[model samples]
Target: MPCRWLLAPGKALRTRFARPLRCDVNNSRRMLSFLSSMSPDNAELRAEVARTRLSVAVGCITEVRGADAIVNCANEHLVGTQLPYINLDGAAGCVFHCVDGVVHKRAGPELHEACMSLAIEEGSYTETWGGIRCPSGQARVTPAFSLPHCAHIVHVVGPPWPSDAEELRDAYSAGIKAALAVEGPEARPAIRSLAVPAISSGIYQWPRDMSWAAAVQSLGGHLLEASLRRGGAGELPCPQDGARSGLDHVIFSAWDAASGREVEECLRRWVDGTLTEDGLL
Candidate 1:
């Protein structure tokens, strides 16, 4: 169903969706208790949303099922170019290189056409790197095309090596916000669940720990901002109808087991107060 924005006096702008995912204050407390008892892979976001759930897992982005959107760690060009390491083996040896190539390969040439449309028709091109579509620290949204079990793809450009931590954080924040801003039929949020990869840690060569830190910080900052807007002290806003569609899930889909573990650890630290907004090291 389509979503609409709810703006009330002295209230934060909330995304309202059709189906009701009820979470009363008591239910929210129970949910929080249940989350704390669960593993770090299923950590608490502290957002206190009626239906939002945070998760970290090791899996391929293409394999993630049921998410409304999946984030692509795209380069500035948005052409879904493979990493050099895989290119060395020749196209016959490897079909895809990084997350961008993998997602684009799975979604077919139509995805590329859509990106090109955004670049040319929509004028999303940037002057960076001798001119490219979708600059660093920003995000663009497109149809998922042939990707199974997904509705949209949020393409985000991460900062290259030697960039500041804020750039990396902005990359993530922009992706999440882009998903929230995407409007489907009748102006509803195009996506509620977003599957994100550990961007820039792969070909961009950012340190794993630092990369995860920036990601966690961005996640926390956005969610916390939402909670504060709702005037949440220890309770989540839970209305009978028109439940907020403000990100039901933000799944951290790691490319490997080790990266998944790192993401979970960083999330756990955030939940335990060991990590803060400026936690990037």
Candidate 2:
């Protein structure tokens, strides 16, 4: 599939600072500042900008209520972390333990093979969850088990960053594709997938700003495109179009409160006129 790119307008503001003159060394006088002449309320705008930027960076992870299924960032082994030991041990242990019994009972040997095969073809199933041994080491996908609400847990490895910018863009695009691909007779009515921060910034060591930019751009593009497809204005095939089609809703999960707020604000801005050009809301 051809990759889609969405660009958001820049909102950077520039501030100027006065330079000290060497000739004034003997003078104990200071030049009057224009900033002081302005209303003290101006500082509020600067503070608001700072707050907004921080919110944007943190991103969001929502529960996606009423979704068919929620995707978890899994470990490679597919054994979720055990609970009770979660806080002390970390996410891996918690996830492993949470779904271990359920997954082990249902995963079976065939499922394992299928997962391995998919992992081989698509890098790691969940790109944001695992780590690489070194800069040049091969990537690993985090493992996750299936739950009852969703028919299938579609695992895909998002591309590592600092590489081809276009390819990185495609990874986000592919995630939507994966979600769409699961729309068959046996699929659920509303499919929801959770996305992490992606592989570049965390253990993968990709720059945070760049990674975030790519994620927002790609996800926003796909969502808009999907909407268009469903509306019948676009040529793209949407699973929801078919009779008895088992597809509804696409959800992106943010990892923390700050991140969640960022996504929410972005979506709100996109929905309103503030961020209309970005096609994200």
Candidate 3:
């Protein structure tokens, strides 16, 4: 018989099913109770989620060195070459230059045409969350030339932000969902997702806190739900032993010190039991 999987809210699961994996079943039950007793508040949960997202963002800045795919906060034109580090500083420039020269050389024109077809303009690029308009039907493949250790480039238009806009929130949610869906059909055993600071907040004029909140909520919700489904329903692909392949890890890479500090503080509160009971931290 196939194994079963279940999807439950993180809080509820932590409360009702926080058990240890042990050879003996009774000890596991005891462990669950202990964890339940220590559950954090919703506020704390929200804060922690924000902090975790921030940490992942910071890590992404450095994590690109070994990832299979790195999602870019690309413009509608896919004119990634215009970016400061990629274009100006030779030392920093080569870091993101994928090995596949074609992807690097052609990404701009190819992305531009796709955006134009969708009626998305350069001014509107960061405003709306544009989908990858590549000619290829697959979301994982980008026109950028491949780089060492990195197999693919996933292009997702970060939702242009007033930061708090519902559209932006939806875009963040959609982006994560899209990435997760890719792994759903693949034979690969694992995949990773990395997000840059969405548009609108930086040069786009979006609010920072709201943008941060939206991202955390979307990614955390997806991860928690996906983990449950994998563990309970067995819908997720697993290894030959029948263990499902879910998000092995999700990271947020902050590009600067301020961003990094903000993320770390939130994480500290979550782990230290400073968050509220409702899980909103």
- Tell me the alpha-carbon RMSD of every candidate: 14.3, 17.0, 15.0
**CA shift at 96, candidate 3, in angstroms?**
16
Off by over 4 Å in 2: 1-65, 69-114, 117-149, 186-201, 207-212, 229-240, 243-247, 268-281
Any idea what lDDT model 1 has? 0.68
Clashing pairs in 1: 3-188
Better of 2 and 3 by lDDT: 3
Please name the candidate that would achieve the greatest TM-score relative to the true structure.
1
Local accuracy of candidate 3 as per-residue lDDT tens digits, 148-206: 44544565555442222444545555455445455423344334544434322443334
Give the Cα-based TM-score of candidate 2 against the true structure: 0.44
Cα lDDT for residue 116, candidate 2: 43
Ranking by TM-score: 1, 3, 2
Question: How many clashes in each candidate?
Answer: 1, 23, 48
Which of the two, 1 or 2, has more lDDT?
1
Q: Please, what is the whole-model Cα lDDT of each candidate in the order they appear?
A: 0.68, 0.37, 0.42
Kindly list the per-residue Cα lDDT of model 1 for residues 1-281, writing each as its tens digit: 23334343344765422333345785475346434423353234352431345677677898897689999988777777743444544653334457887898899999988887774424553443224668788999999999997989999999865466656777997898788888766566667678888888666666666677777767654555455455542344443211243565677888889888887777767766565323333
